[model samples]
Structure formats: structure tokens, C-alpha cells
Target: MHTHGTETPVNAPSAEIPMTAHKTQAPTTDRSAELFEQAREVLAGGVSRNTLLRAPHPIYAERASGCRIVDVDGVERIDFANNMAALIHGHSHPAVTAAVTAQLEHGTAYTMATRAEIDYALQLRRRAPGFEKMRFMNSGTEAVMAAMKASRAYTGRHKIAKVEGTYHGGYDYAEVSQAPAPHNWGPAERPASVPLAKGTPESVLQEVVVLPYNDPEAAVAVLNEHRGEIACVVLDLMPHRLGLIPAKDAYVVALRDWTREDGALLVLDEVITFRTEVGGMQTRYGVSPDLTAMGKVIGGGLPVGALAGRAEVMEVFSAGAGGPRLPQSGTFSANPLTITAGAAAMKLYDAEAVARMNRLGTLARARIEEAIAVAGAPASVTGAGSMFRIHMKAEAPTDYRSSYPSAEEKALLSHFVDGLYDHGVMAIHTGAGALSTPMDEAVIDQLADAVLASLRKL
Candidate 1:
């Protein structure tokens, strides 16, 4: 079995050789399987998240540190998924671990606010001008929910608009049309508010106006139809499920203008893309949203989320006057452990760290592009700043509708991802990856070589 800090395993497949040149599967899964079987009796689907499930069974992790994770079978793979892009510094980062450990010794949570919260908020405010005032929540979903609700409260409107196929967590309104199919998705000009789950209230669907991504003109027309009723336009700059294609600058400008004209707010979902830039990807767009929902890296591998925005808009959550317009509170919100860990992580991920990581990201994408060309495979890569997704199409997709994969393509992607795992790389099943601070050119090269090998299989 390979130990934690080894350069690479003795028999690990090299980028120079074909993936099939060595053992293509984990040496042993008996322990992981045994634990999963026992878990099935208690936990739903033998795992806490559907994302953790695999073909035969889910692999159980024994431990992880830096950019590597060791499964129960003792297979150590370079972690590119990073817990679905949440771990900015990767698993068990020393600074975050030590900070959390220290906080644990003090206390976990309390009804009274901690100085840690104020200190962390100031750090964030200094990082992003959009974060004028902020409030912490337990998860990204909560942060998004708070943002949407706060928007409605601020605007006193019933309707909310969201780009088609962008995920903004599990909030009913926010999740509407997250994965609409051609059969149900109305038209390119004006998308129908498709419900993600069964029994989702029709009223909830009606209140959400779906805008086609990257189509500024169409989005404007759709928003015009709802004009005064829309509370805010919620968006993700680079939606992961949407093939990780970035929102066009024109599209963002259009939305910002329309929202302002319609007397509605513009909310940016920076949950996943926060790691893309020091101040979030919004900074790159040259747009400042009325509110920003944040998560993922901020928690430093712990559960955390935050909503920040223009003070006037965020004032709804405040009670300085007499019972504010919106009352928001979570028992674990801004708890010492999460704050300490997040502060340590964010402090380490300074401007220089962000620039270095993004440079590595650029190298990674360039290498993957080269691999795709060499394999002569119908594949493409899309992303910006430390994140990228491999699409099984020759051309990069322009929007969600175009990005939606065929059944065959889905199967092919799954097979390709599985191949990557067999080659000692754990990537997101969607063929997406978020680079972490610990990754360097060597790791990126390994990933590219794996891509080349996997594409050949296809």
C-alpha cells in the first residue's frame, strides 16, 4: 500500500505509457465494499450524496491530505473533484486543519455571535467590494435561498429570473429549470419554468422566469414580459452543469441593465466560481451585482455559506430599526470552527496564490486541448480560472441547450471518467475539474496524459 507523502506509487501508471500498460483497477475493494454494504442498511442509497454513488458501489475514503485521497482499498489518487469544487486548498490542508482543531478545543457553536464572524466578514469585504455587508449561513443552498428571499423582500416582487440550466442550490425558485430537456423546455426565445422535482408546486414554477443562457436579446425580451414582477435575476458566471461555459459579457451587461430598468436586483451565485478569482469571477466581468451568494472554498472543507451585497439590500436581514423586513438566523451560522478554518484557508489563498493557481489552470486547459487534438477525438474544454470541463463534442458549447449531451455521449463521458479513475485520477463524473492550491504543472501534466489515454479508449 502507498503511504501519504510518496511522490508516486511504485507501480503507478506513467503519463508516458498507455493507461492499460499497468493494473487498470484498484487492487482491493473488499474493505470499501464491506463498509458500503453495511451503510446501505442505515444510510439512504448506501451514501449521503447521490454524487458519491458509482456503478458497483461507492468507494469509501480512508483518509486524505493535500491533493490526494486514499480509499479503503489503499488506492491513492490525485483528487481533482475536490469534493465537487468545495475544497479550495484540497483535503486536510494543514493551516485549515490546525485552525479548526484549535477552535474545536474552544467550542463549536453558540447563540451568541463570535468575534471570528466579524473578523472573517471584514476579510471578505476587503476582498470583494460587492460584499459591503454580509450574513453567514450553513450551506450554499441556504445562502442562495437567503439571497432570493432577500431579493423578493427588497423588491416586494413575486417573480424571480434565472438563467436556464444554471444550478443555484436546492431552493425551489433557484432550482427551477436547472435541467430542462428539449421536450419540456419551451423555446429558445423564452424558456418555460421547468420543475426539477416531482410535486414542485406549479405556483413556484410560475413565479420563476427562465432565461436562455448567453442570449442577451432573448433574456431581455423574457424579462420585459415579466417587467415589474421579477424581483431579481440570479446567475452563475460559469455554471458547472452547463458545460462550464462562461456567461458572455454582453449577456451579463444585458441582465444588469434590464434588472436596473425593471427595478429588480441582480444576484450573482459565486458558490462555485468564487475560487476563480480573488474577488470572485464577477470582478472579471466588470459588473457588481446587488447581492452575491458564496460558498464552497470559503468554508475551508467545512460546511459554510454567506450572502453579501449592497448594504441597503442586505438591510432587510438587519433588525436595528425594529424587526427587519427579513429575519435570518442559523444555529451554526458563523460558528467558530468554520470561521477559523475558512479564515486560515482564505488567508493562505492570497492574491499571489490565486494568480499562481490560475496560471496552472491555464496550463491544464492548454494541455487538455493538446491531448484532444492528438487523440483526434470529438472533445473540447471550457472554463476559466482554475476550473475546466471536458465536453464530448468537437466544438465548445455556446449555451445549455447546445451543451446538453445525447444519451450515447453521456455513456461515453461516464466511460471516459471511469477510465480516468482507473488511471489514478478521481474527476467529477461530469468530466469537470477544479484545480487546488497544492496542484502544480506535474499534476496538470498527469491529468492531461490521462485524458489522452482515456480519449484513445473512446
Candidate 2:
């Protein structure tokens, strides 16, 4: 129910990606870069995921437990990225590992539904706003894709709307619609639907329409224009990728109202925002979206995703004429292992747990702000609950446009993130988001000092 008292407006999402080869910081890369070259000969890009393949070479993690990750070089650093905000309880939590181990004894996957999966869905339904039933998947991408398909089938519409700068996943539909860079994405406002990676035909991109994040007027206008053709308007509750910018209350309220008037499903993607609370960001914002996309913490450091919302919309999976007609099949969807691990993780995440983490986050942010102020750096932190991002700019952005950095600014931010590692503090290369539970006041204080020092050097 609390709103950020500050009246600062946010910027929109946008960045001019480079055509040149990705840069590297060899001096700072350490042995990780050397090992990456060996990895590249066999493993394309020396990494499994395109995002993981950073400049120079990615650090090969040898061990991770709780708040720390040890690279192959035997260097330990505090993990603020937490696997892109997935590790809500942090790495190697005893409960999660034990649950997974126990599930392994029973079986990892059976292709049939498991009791744990049903229980997990029930668990989420209990917390989600207006949640009726749910389905499971192996990743946020699958969850998002299913939601889109269900919307399309339910409404008999082919077009879908998305917020700019939101990265859903690597599926053909998702990547082409949202993922930026190397994809030859067209103009900023009205981008040409471009596939991020290979294999996605130009055909898929034609179905997606990109909209400005945190701009309700644009959304209203576009929806009016696309009315009969649009199935759903999928977007992050917060403009997370554009330096973790948050949408305004006015905009959220506006979109919710407009969607109701237009008879289109409102798909709220909470994959990253799930860390905010036990009930998810929808609970925090009090928005009852038609369908909700979920992932990250729900997997308990494993891989899982889910879609849940009002029964009227979610029932598209049930059996009946014009009733639950979409098909959602994932081999590992709702596997017992991930469900058990996820349930175990969620068990420990109560309101008190959220409070503790938020306190630590608030402490860390306050200290870092103090340091920024002292150094007089044009930097700021923004986000809600236990998640936040470090962005270097004079003002706090209101949307993606104001939030995104120029190409030079991003390079500088990446360099700064690498510098944080040099100072024994590790952050996501994107300069967005941190995790909780493994971290405490002491760890937060340590990171605050390190972040302050890093900013001072800049």
C-alpha cells in the first residue's frame, strides 16, 4: 500500500546496440577469460546462454553457497546478481538442496503430473490476486508463451502487445518480439519486429507490437488502434531491463482500466518481481491482472515458471467448447523436484522474511546513496521490495525511455560492474537487481562500502 513518496518521473526504454564485436576487459577478466577461449572452440560463444557470454570471457563458477560464488580462479565474491534475481533465498540453501535430493530419490521427472506440482500451483493460487488455477513450465519463457497463446485462443486474436525493454525469454515468439540487440530491431518507438537469435522467421515478429513502458497514454492509443486484432497486452509491472525503472501508479491504474474497457487480457509478467513478496508484485500493487506470468524464485534456484490468474481467463486449459481450449505441454513442467524445492524455498519466505530482506536492501541502498551523495556522483538506486538496480544518471527515471543509458553509458556501467567484482562485490552485468535471504545487515554493509568505493573511483 506504500508508494515511493518521491515525485521523480521515469524514462522510457531504448538503447542503440553496437554492430561491432562485444568488448572485453582482459586485465580485469583474470583466468576466466583464458578458460573461456578453450570453451569457445567447443561451446558456441564459450557460454550456454547468449546473456551469459560477457566481454573478455565469463567467469567460470566453481562453487556457490549462500551469498558467495567462487570462480575457477578460487576468487570469492559477494553475489548481488543472484542469477539475474532468480536466487531469492540465495545459492545452495540447505532446504532447497535437501528437497531436491529427496525428490531425486523419488524421481526427477516422469512426464506425468506430480502431486508436488499441483501443490505448488495451489500454493501460488493461494497468494496471487484473484488467482483461480495455474499451469507450470520449465522457464519464464514457457510460462510467458503459454499465457500469450491462451490469450490468443481465448480472444481469437493474433496480435499481442509488450512493453519495450522487457526480456521475456529466448523462444521464437518472445525473442523476436522483445529481445533487443544484434536482432536489427527497427525504429525506437515503433520497432520492426526482429528476432534476437537465428531460426525465428520474420513471420513470428509480425504478430507482436512493441509499446513504450510506463506510458499508459501510448498503451491506450495503441490498444484503440489495434483493438479487434490484439489478444493480450503483456508487460513487466516494472520496466526492469531499462535500468529497473518502475511504472507509475497512474499508468498501472490506467492500463488496468483501459484493458477492462477494451475486453483484452492484461498479462502481468512477475518473473523478476516475484522476489518482492510472498504474494508477488500484484499483491504489492493491488492489481488483479487477467493472467500472471511467473518465474525466478518460484523454482528455488532450479528452473520453473507458471501462469495463473482469474479463472475466466486461466480456464483456457480446461476441456470444453470455448472453454479451456489451449494446449500447454512441457516435459519437465511441474516436475516434482522443482516443485518440492520451490515449496521448500517458499515455506521459509514469510512476511517476516520479506521484511528482513527489505530492511537489508533499504540499509544497503541508504548507505550507497550516502556514498553517492558524498562523492556527488550522478547515480541513483531504484526498485521495490528486496530488489534494486544501480543506475548512473542525475535523475530517477519514470519509465524505460528516461531509464535507459546511451551506448557509452552502458559500457561505462558494465565497466563499473566489473570494477565492483575487482572490489570483491559481484553484480549483474546489466547493473540491475540483487537478491536476499543469504544476505544480512553485515553483508549489506560490506556491499554498501564496496559500492561506495566503486562509485568514488568513477
**lDDT: which candidate is best?**
1
C-alpha TM-score for every candidate = 0.94, 0.88
lDDT of each: 0.87, 0.74
Error of 1 at 326 (Å): 0.5
Q: How does residue 91 of candidate 1 score in lDDT?
A: 76
Question: lDDT per residue, candidate 1, 333-415, as tens digits?
Answer: 99888899889889888888888778878888998899899999998999999999999988988899888999988889988
For candidate 2, the 10 contiguous residues with the lowest summed lDDT are 7-16
lDDT measured at residue 58 in model 1 versus the true structure, 0 to 100: 82
User: TM-score winner among the candidates?
Assistant: 1
Q: Which pairs clash in model 1?
A: none
Supply the TM-score for candidate 1. 0.94
lDDT of 1: 0.87
lDDT of 1 at 255: 94
lDDT of 1 at 177: 95
